[model samples]
Target: MAAYTVPKAFPTTVVGSYPKLPSAQEALRRQRKGEISEDEFKRLVREAIRGVIEDYIWAGVDILSDGEQSREDMVVYFAERLRGYAPGEWVRIFDNVYFRKPIIVGRVEWVSPMALDDWEYARSVSGGRPVKVILTGPYTMLEWSFDLHYGDRREAILDLARAIRREVDEYLARGAKYVQIDEPALSTRPWREEAELAGEALEVIFRGVSAKRIVHICFGRIERILPYILDYPVDQFDLEFKNSNFRLLPYLKEYGYDKELGYGVIDVHSLQVESVEEVKKAIDYLMKLDIIGPEKIYIDPDCGLKRLPRRIAREKLRNMVEAAKLARKEWAGEE
Candidate 1:
């Protein structure tokens, strides 16, 4: 998304946020309680990032991430860093799961780069592979947070977009080649209503920042956003095909969604590690659909692997890399 080169066919990557190492998680918890110094916590997180980068390189992934080891949660992490926001009461995100959702206390602004150090650290350890910076999209950030300051949703979302664009611009200026904005809310309920706002926000974030910009939307009603989503200002639309049993593939094909795809070949929500055969089959189905080719796809999990155990996530990535290689060979008639 710095000096772009054509990736190998079926380039294996991730949607970011791998399962945190036990030591890193413990360090975070201790830091929260003031039992560990900030410097110590950061050292642990950097170690975790190095470990993650090694795993991806060893597993043969083409594109990689910092694995978001330092992040507490996607939305909360960015919210805490940005100006004019504060943590609100604990709120449930899923069944029996709660997070400290932020409330917008004033006009949102970006005071500094939120993900630069980690991205640069990952790059140093990534064996020269492309490491993407994953930022929570402005729309998602606005949607997840309580808007006490800006009563108008458009005003709040656009302002957040302006804030995130600065982060994106910084990454581009600093030589980041890939950047992804996670916007699961784009496919959530009332998605039709939010599509226009999301588009406008995307416009701001990507206005002039040119990298391999990606928009990842998973685990929601993707079918509803079809043709409309095809127009968002991103180079790729990373969606969940494995989670929906590839049911959404037909729509993308039907809508002629013609951009690079971050293909979901692994299911992260499931504890069972996907066999290489399963991952290959998923890739084959997309190829069979004939809407896009291997060169235009990035083999990946349905979403971030934070929900799985660390071992399970690693195994899943291993299988994914194997599957992508297998698919690549077959596509080339090398096997």
Candidate 2:
């Protein structure tokens, strides 16, 4: 069981939102309209990223993320940013959900160290509160992207992991303390034959990142695969809580896991802001178990705040942060 330690000050973070630039909306519209070139869209995305970082910093968030506003698609853009990858045609996940695929045309090559200036921008925003850097996990990146070169997904994931590891080192060298690797696809249900293969990919992807890592297992059936991740050496597990997967909390107890849990107390999927009382209720639900502690827990929304309007997102985060403060005070029996 994990021990409790109330943070001196409430520590709050989001999966990745706050740095998306305003041009994001227009860029999306243009991309859908097929009116802009890929290169132009990427430039606009960079601008939107700058805007997101500025907005989040001004909003008083303790830990800020790049908001990932500029990339045409989250996983695909990572491919476009790399040197040895080719932008493949667009593919749909289900119905209307579409993303570009980066085809692995050649062996991975690094022309320059991959870095997003979101952390530096956030430091300027918080006057320095340790910006939380966000990236797509190598496993998710490989699975999400089109790989034409390698037959073995493990090799592809490991290669991608090594490239991203270099990027992580660069980000940490630039002073990033908290790095979030988003593996949303981990929740998808694939055939049983693919499970071990997926696990292998996951193992290779996380091989060399630092100790302060957050593996975001959003958008998937976490209960079935929590065991695979429980064995990994990540520090925090950021999963969806505002939505109905509260069943997984008990699974943490069942597994006797002891990492810090980031609970999504507010509903970021909607415009409605969660009340401080609601936030308390969420934490109280988790605190009922002795496996995790209040201090080891971080409060947040269900996921990224990108789709939310600026005012609504701000209000939602403000209430969530305030709720964390209130919860901390109450938990400590402080006035």
Candidate 3:
């Protein structure tokens, strides 16, 4: 694997998902209720994915994805595909959102390649732009699922690390340039011991694969994980700063974080779209920090746009790209 380089300063991208088309969402519900055939559900999912990819291209996003339209939830999607996991009762994650929690009934195993086809399809439709292959990290997958089989949590996480690595290897073999491991649960861990264990699990997952490794951790006070997380073997850290009002930047600078930074300038949790100027302001503030250089910065939304309206997600991405262009010009001293 070659060194991953940023194409340009403030290159705009997304954090994996775009809002699912309403029809696609309905197809998911119908499929779950057995009201629709599996073939019918997959056809609608493909259509939704293609439309989302088109939106990304139209919005001028620098890096693209398949919008994760085929997935209901990140962890559960993989759980459904991987062996040794059984769906339990629906559990509430937040207000009005629920998922069937996964229970580990046996040793976790990777029966086949997951997301490789999705990556291939996304790359085919990307108009030659790099498409990021995203997956739920081992630590997050283990943390999110109930461990009824593995007696020790550490053992379970490590097993998951091995299982997910197989999927990563397949993605690389199929020509994925960038791969992001979504580990949002890392920040919210109740104990530092768990965080340490999670770090070890990351090493197991990331050791030697090497294709521009990125870890996206969001929605929690990252200050807790800090310099420890910086030690993880990854090229770049994709994180949420907009939702936290860029509070982590000071900590990052204080801790002397030296890796490439994926800065989030748009808040995905809100319906209100950020203006071009507002987005530019966020980027400008980070540029002035001097800790992360312009060449190392990649701009994106705070997190996935799955909860927001589809039109709003598209508009937000357009604003993000426009902001990046203006920021690039300013950094390059162009009028």
Best by TM-score: 1
TM-score of each: 0.95, 0.83, 0.94
lDDT per residue for candidate 3 within 1-335, as digits (tens), equals 33333356777789998898866798788988999887788778777877888999889898888888878899899999999999977889999999888888999989998777667777777778788999998888887888899989888988898898888888878767788989999888736787788788778767887688899999997888886777888889999999999999999889998898889888999999999999999988887888877778889998899999988988999999998889989985532
Query: What is the per-residue lDDT of model 1 for residues 1-335, given as tens digits with 9 covering 90 to 100?
Result: 24434356888899999888876798779877989887788888899998888888777787899999989889998998899898888999888988888999999999998878889989887767888889999888988888899999999999999999898888888888888999988888546658888988999998876688899999888899776777888899898889888899888888887899999878888998899998988888889999887778889999999888888888999999899889989985533
Computed on alpha carbons, the lDDT of every model, listed in order, comes to 0.86, 0.69, 0.85
Query: What is the alpha-carbon lDDT of model 3 when measured against the actual structure?
Result: 0.85
Q: How do these models rank on lDDT, best leading? A: 1, 3, 2
Candidate 2: list runs displaced more than 4 Å.
1-10, 23-59, 93-97, 189-211
| Window of ten residues with lowest summed lDDT in model 3 | 1-10
Residue 144 lDDT (model 3): 86
Q: Which residue pairs of candidate 3 clash?
A: none
How far off is residue 236 in model 2, in Å? 1.2
Instruction: Between candidates 1 and 3, name the one with more favorable lDDT.
Output: 1
Among all windows of ten consecutive residues in candidate 1, which has the lowest summed lDDT? 1-10
Number of the candidate with higher lDDT, 2 or 3: 3
